[model samples]
Target: MSFTIAIIGRPNVGKSTLFNRLVGQKLALVDDMPGVTRDRREGEAKLHDLSFTIIDTAGLDEGPKGSLTARMQEQTETAIALADALFFVIDARIGLTPADRAFADFARRADKPVLLLANKSEGKHGELGAMESYALGLGDPIQISAEHGEGMGELYDAVSKLVPPTEDEDEEHEETDEERAARPIRVAIVGRPNAGKSTLINHLLGEERLLTSPEAGTTRDSIAVEIEYKGRGFRIFDTAGLRRRSRIEEKLEKLSVADALRAVRFAEVVVLMMDAQNRFEEQDLRIADLIEREGRALVIAVNKWDLMEAQPGQIAGLRRDADHWLPQVAGAPIVAVSGLMGEGIDRLMQAIVQSYAVWNRRVPTAALNRWFEGAIANNPPPAVSGRRLKLNYITQTKARPPSFVLFCSRADAIPQSYLRYLVNSMRETFELPGTPVRITLREKANPFAHKRKRPN
Candidate 1:
């Protein structure tokens, strides 16, 4: 169960600043100009041991309230109603005002737990304004410098107190494998413009929510759509078709590229869609390399397969080309599908689920050590500077793409080639093809051996 917290205040009170602070990222655009944020941006937030959702709302203002402002206010109010707690922020440098009082009354009427924050309280000049926050009748104000990151401990305490602990059943329920598998698999469809990305999504969803045409670059934003396939939930992200950076002249195209990169970062698996006629372009390789660099699971879908006029052994020729050109993602599952005709959709989904499972796999410590020993036995680590390097043990330190740390006698002397050998061996042994594996070599610490002996 996740809780949401809304940051509400007038313009330039550091509401966006505080939202970024709580979320631990600059996800929301922050500028000195008033009314910079027009939309309600949300992010995952963590405070101490608690993790929740944080919403950055547009600055509340007074007017006959135009449609945009009214919509912003409605979004803020919706967040307030849904949130377990709210952070009512005010600029301490400017002190309290009638507008602040008006909003305080609005929060009071809502009957929700409100944490009054006196933001911009970094200097002595803001002391009086911080003291003035008490007049809002929202209880004692927590002095904070959202920009400077002061008083976060108190904020964490306040939020944790407001949101109750998770029930034991809920905690246990999350531990089940079914629960783990039930999480929506984040999948990103990436390719060049007019490469049938939007068409593919529209076909999968059996709707026309996405605008599709022969024109290139029709979709500028990365749009996420949720669908259940065979009773499994999948969150598919349709990203803008990324063109070569040198060719991107328009400002919107630049933004679109950034958005596509962001989508790649957020996705667990990337489905690289390509036109069968124009497959394996330089830009396509660049996109595939980006996915590989991000250590994401990958599945290549050759779209427009129905339109391809092929002779005998054409499909075999294409497979050989893929094997030779994309050796980094060797053995990646490639499905020749016509998104227009909905061919191979089921096989594509199965490949996606399988790739996602491989991406999230965890190798036990004992099994990992055994594999490491076997690998070393098969191909020993090379001797360096007349010294044979001894690799003691290997253990996985992290999992979302499976990272391991190898404790060795001399980590600095280990060459990159040896590391690659170990990684390749692990990939083959664990059947983790087409997925990037990270192996870090570290010198083992020997505390007892380093201590000096005491002579009586």
Candidate 2:
């Protein structure tokens, strides 16, 4: 069986940062603020030759029921229950607090193998804090700086010891010729300039691997990074910031935008990043609509939230704005994050995984046809050539923005407005928000039902 490790800690302790380090991508958001992560994010991780599943959990906190803090804690608890081992992270620069102690106790009660980590241990200043980690009673501490990538060897050793040898498992998992031909998840990250797209990537890689600048249009080409998640490999494409056509004065900028659009077409999941200050700009909506039109799974992320003054109403307000402006993508999970500060990174990742799950969701043909029948019963297809269009059968042809092919009569005569209605109805009925749904109408020829014509 594949080993599973959970990264647990208090807020701002670099749990998500360490997660990205292990997963080899800036898949998680990092920020200085506490309680930024409010969900459990899972990814495939590898250290040296060791491979395992990694769960990045929200920082633990005590609060009233249904509150964000409480919900985060609950999510962490869920991670604790699911993990085979736990990596309890603490900030070496800040030392431990009562909250950390409380969470340590919680982890102890879970009875799973636990590794204490003193993260951010880059210099002598962090040494004292690393030494102090012994008090947690979780055994010797592994000191490392997730941001600078210091002391990764010790982390690899510690994790290797906790996980059983996978030599035989590896042999069993070696892919045959047919297995190697399987398609991989195609992901593209598109956003406006300086929306933390590169920062987010750097965070995932746990290194300053991407060139980041304050200037707009810094990235000129699409970069592809392949990594594993949940024991499966995924290909993530980071594309250049898309600017409006009117602003494309430079040839290089025009090329970059075209390249970004091409990336969108190739992606199965198109993650659209938005600057928190300009959450739902016309350009943002346009990008989302374009993704939908291309039949790609969509996930919206709000970046650079550290600079914003967030209130209790901020998330609600953003949700309302998304619904009002991008109704086609309604119910799309909008994760608030500060890519620079790393806040809300875990939640963002969880949302990605969830959206991916939905994108790959396939409804049974029987159930789908039943729903189709009900939809047709509720609102019949528009009349064409003085005859009502007959939609006979529907079958899901593909997923990753679930696509269906409908066998019907007079497919060529079907109106675009009616197709839009069907698409909207499917979206609402299937709870597929923020992602595209494709339906192809094909005319069916009757064989047995038709009378034999005079020999033609």
Candidate 3:
């Protein structure tokens, strides 16, 4: 296992910025608001020739027991326990506060190697704050501006002294391109606030790995957890619930929403969880539509099934409603899952595997062209402005959502309704249910257009 370090401090001390800097990617959400990050996030980080694991944690605070704030702190504590070292950060621009002093003691009690980071140390005031941080007795503060990429050399030196890389670790086999391609299937779970997304993921992992509470908007970052089911590996991302655009008033929420969207785009399959009681609302439909528009394989989970009164044909009814409300994603898998009780867990995982297969399915050219011929024979292109549109050959361009290209006499004359017809027909013909299918129409170039015709 790689050496792990946890960054912990009072809220808004540039911890996330430092994490992003180390990971070389903007994987975590960062904002001016304190406590924007509620859950702990892990990433593989590299500095110079050194490689290790880094964890970004929620801000340390004194929250009332059993409160959401307390749970956030609990998440931080969990990260601390998991880490081999600590990066105790403070905002150098504003100098140290009582909160920082208090958390300093908390770090000491962990009895692990702690590196004091005075972030935002890019000015005279910052230097003064770094000097003040020495009073905490952690050691000489490393003056670094995580945002500006300053003092990284000093940081590398400090971290090297604490945990030097071993030759065996350096000889460890690096994951190759083929290995990456065959890695775990990426899946993201998303829905409205308090839809039991976290609960479902926890149930899957058989542990309370993610911080969850009854309160809405407890999650503010897209947290990815890797797990296996029936010998297949999957990297599941639990995202912050997406609300209506107008309802997103705070900057932090907006950042969270953006992060969730990035996760959706990054994922190979997305599971949209909804409250079993209030499922299929307008917003739910909107989210489903958004996923289809993004061209990702989707699975709808009606969560909290235990709360609903089980009725005869309820499962069938759920299917009918899913198809009716969101025909764009027609034939998509719908599973009634109680994330709390682990009901329908096997079915959900099966659905995800099936959906991923469908998403990456590619059709043979011969079979595709044969279907095209039959489709045009059944209902040829309609005449527009007294001229019959000549439909030419069709070919499948790619698959991961099964897109195709159609050569026609007049591409501009093709109606969207006609395109929808072709999309539906191809979907039915190819057994591609619940996956987005794209078809592009191109006008065939006339062979004799350039030849000057003799006046007859």
lDDT tens digits, residues 1-456, model 1?
478888988888999889878789765656676765554566778776777878777777765554545655765776677777788999999999889999999988888889999999888867889999999999989989989999898887787787654434444333667767788999999999989998888788897546565768767657667789998999988888899889999765776778788989999999999999999999889988889899999999899999988689876776787767776777677888898999879989999999988888899878888898899999999999999999998889887898888888978999988887887788888888777788887888877997889998
Instruction: Give a tens-digit lDDT track for model 2, residues 193-256.
Output: 7777878876776655445668776665566666565555567777778877798786656656
Task: Kindly report which residue stretches of model 1 are placed more than 4 angstroms away from their true locations once superposed.
Answer: 1-177, 312-318, 446-456
| Candidates, ranked, TM-score | 3, 1, 2
What TM-score goes with each of the models? 0.62, 0.56, 0.94
- The deviation in Å at residue 244 for candidate 3 is 1.3
Clashes of each: 0, 16, 0
Number of the top TM-score candidate: 3
Candidate 2 lDDT trough over 10 residues, lowest sum = 164-173
Between 2 and 3, whose lDDT is larger?
3
lDDT (0 to 1) per candidate: 0.83, 0.80, 0.92
